[model samples]
Target chain A: MNYPSKLIEQAVLEISKLPGIGKKTALRLALHLLKQNEQTVEGLTGALSRLKKETRYCERCHNLSDGPLCTVCASPSRQENVICVVAEVPDLIAIENTGQYRGTYHVLGGILSPMHGIGPEELQVASLLERVKSAGEEMEIIFALPSTMDGDTTSFYLMKLLKPFGVNISTVARGIPIGGELEYTDEVTLGRSILARVKYDFGG
Target chain B: MNYPSKLIEQAVLEISKLPGIGKKTALRLALHLLKQNEQTVEGLTGALSRLKKETRYCERCHNLSDGPLCTVCASPSRQENVICVVAEVPDLIAIENTGQYRGTYHVLGGILSPMHGIGPEELQVASLLERVKSAGEEMEIIFALPSTMDGDTTSFYLMKLLKPFGVNISTVARGIPIGGELEYTDEVTLGRSILARVKYDFGG
Candidate 1:
């Protein structure tokens, strides 16, 4: 669509480059920015620019960090022996939000996606292998990656590599969601949940 | 949710301040930006800053503009005697895209909303009156505002104020949309369409 101002057109074009945002939404956002105070717009731009310029990845876990190590990797209370393997930082954050897991995380950056030209080398596989090789015999590795084929492939490849290290390898359970109904649950997940069902424990 | 990096948290906070963007979506967007190259992030921030700093409103019509006059107001082909009053720049652009109208526009900035503390004094009502007073008797004012209560109130208020100018006043027709079916159409709109039906012309 034709824009009244060249500046607004340029702003909308740049905004629409982001994922899930279209030209119409970008235009609406730009117009909204125009209505806001100068300080508000400046604050938004400042925060985004600082995030890009100052943020770094944890050298150990590959999670976003302000310094060499992320808060998870730096925390002493976290169980360093148990590393939860995730496809990305957001996945790590999701697991952290549950508050049940106290283990440290190893962010893979992405799963193995051959279609997208993302192989084992494209991710943090080498760093993960280095960590596993140097860790103690009691170290446990938990795969918290997606249930997709790419995620499974990445997990299998890593498991095979880590076999020689003699560390315990496990994966998060796949089942119906907490509030999901039986009839609506997909067949594959339902079947997997039945096959992996645990013993009924009487104590809470 | 706890973020791995403080910079990511700040970026998410700023991003979620935008319309329709929640914390989860903001985190996703922030993570996506982190994955992008530094130049892409800089380009977006630059465009947004420039849009806010450089853009201006047309003095005559209050439409967004790079200079004193907008493209529509500056165009010689546009009819100066006819004015299409709209609620906002987006509305004007929507009507312009149709290519059915050749008249200039008067942007009200917003409709009359007492709940939002927006009234005649907050909009471009004074400027519209000034323009109407100076124009000739043949000048016509058309209301192309929304069909909502606020839009109607603004149009009615303006119409009453412009009555003494002896200019012709009218509003855009309200009817069923081009591809709309009568069965699914709302009762009020369908009833209004039947009441406002025009003579069917065979020759196109």
Candidate 2:
């Protein structure tokens, strides 16, 4: 049968664009919206509008921020001398949810994947280095980057570049099943990995 | 610890307000936005913005529309002499999907749920009666409303009101489970219900 009004079709088309939502499911969602109270539907629509108008990124850590610096960067009690490097912001949140780590974070934007055309330039690696250098020679860096090969490569590269400052460089313990996504792993295992961290050697 | 930023917190809060989304899920969604490229994140944000700007209610059917009349109302070939009365837009879509019925529809908005303070006034029942009266004596109305108590109440009310105009009043077959949702039952069952519909008795 022919589709409903163009507006309904448009709603279905747009919803289908969401992750894992197909045409059938999209139509179902669109119709569900029709059944909801006008106020509830309007609320959802309003939220979507505000998402663009209200949100921005933290310039310093690349975490979502409403201001120039992220909240973590503005905080006084967190270890300013210790920065934990991570592959992405989700990884940072996973660590934060455990309520264990008190250090600040550096979101790399992504892992170094030459195959995907992702390089150091694509990541926030340069900003991280700049932040570390400015934080001082006494600062120790922790490469809490993911356990993937690309993550290892990124960690190794950062370690070598920072060796001139004679700062401490350590990577999280590796028995984490290489290529495993850190966000899905349990906190106990992740904490154990952090405690069993190993030192990285650079020829500098 | 202090939050990452007010913008991030607000975004998370707004996300948490969505159906089935909690604080932790909101955090995950917010972090996902941070890790994504600006273009990808903006795409989702852009879609959200368009959700409200482009949709409105069709005055004729009270269905969500981008214009004054909804898609079903705008169609030319649909039968005007017959109207299938349903409780919601999703029910309308389910019937439409079967490709069996060719009549136009009137969305009742909801069933008559007195327990929830939802009555005929809250629903589009008045509109259904008005449409029936306006459509004139030649029209036939098949009550495709659900089998729940509220459905029965709504159907009885509509039958009596529409009967005065000499228009035919019919209802969909009723083996539907008591208090069952119209959205989940299979197409075959729904169509069977329509075929087995019996005449309503007005307290003989």
lDDT (C-alpha, whole model) for all candidates: 0.93, 0.73
lDDT of 2 by residue, B119-142 (tens): 779988788777877874498899
DockQ list for all candidates: 0.86, 0.24
Q: Taking the true A–B contacts (Cα pairs closer than 8 Å), what share appears in each candidate?
A: 0.90, 0.32
| Candidate 1 local Cα displacement, residue B108, angstroms | 0.9
Error of 2 at A197 (Å): 13
User: For residue A140, what is the lDDT in candidate 1?
Assistant: 95
Instruction: Single out the weakest 10-residue window by summed lDDT for candidate 1 chain A.
Output: A129-138
Worst 10 residues of 2 chain B by lDDT: B44-53
Q: How big is the positional error of residue A13 in model 2, measured in Å on the Cα after superposition?
A: 3.4
lDDT of 1 by residue, A1-204 (tens): 889999999999999999999999999999999999889999999999999989999999988988999998899998999999999888988898999999899988889999999988888999998998888657899999899988899889999999988899999989999999999999999999999898998997
Per-model tally of clashing residue pairs: 0, 2
What are the runs in model 1 whose C-alpha is more than 4 Å off?
A201-204, B199-204
What tens digits encode model 2's per-residue C-alpha lDDT throughout A1-204?
345556667666665665555787667666656555666665555554455456666777887566777777777988878888888767786778778888888888888899899988998988987887787548778888876688878888888888887788776655555788788777867887788877898869
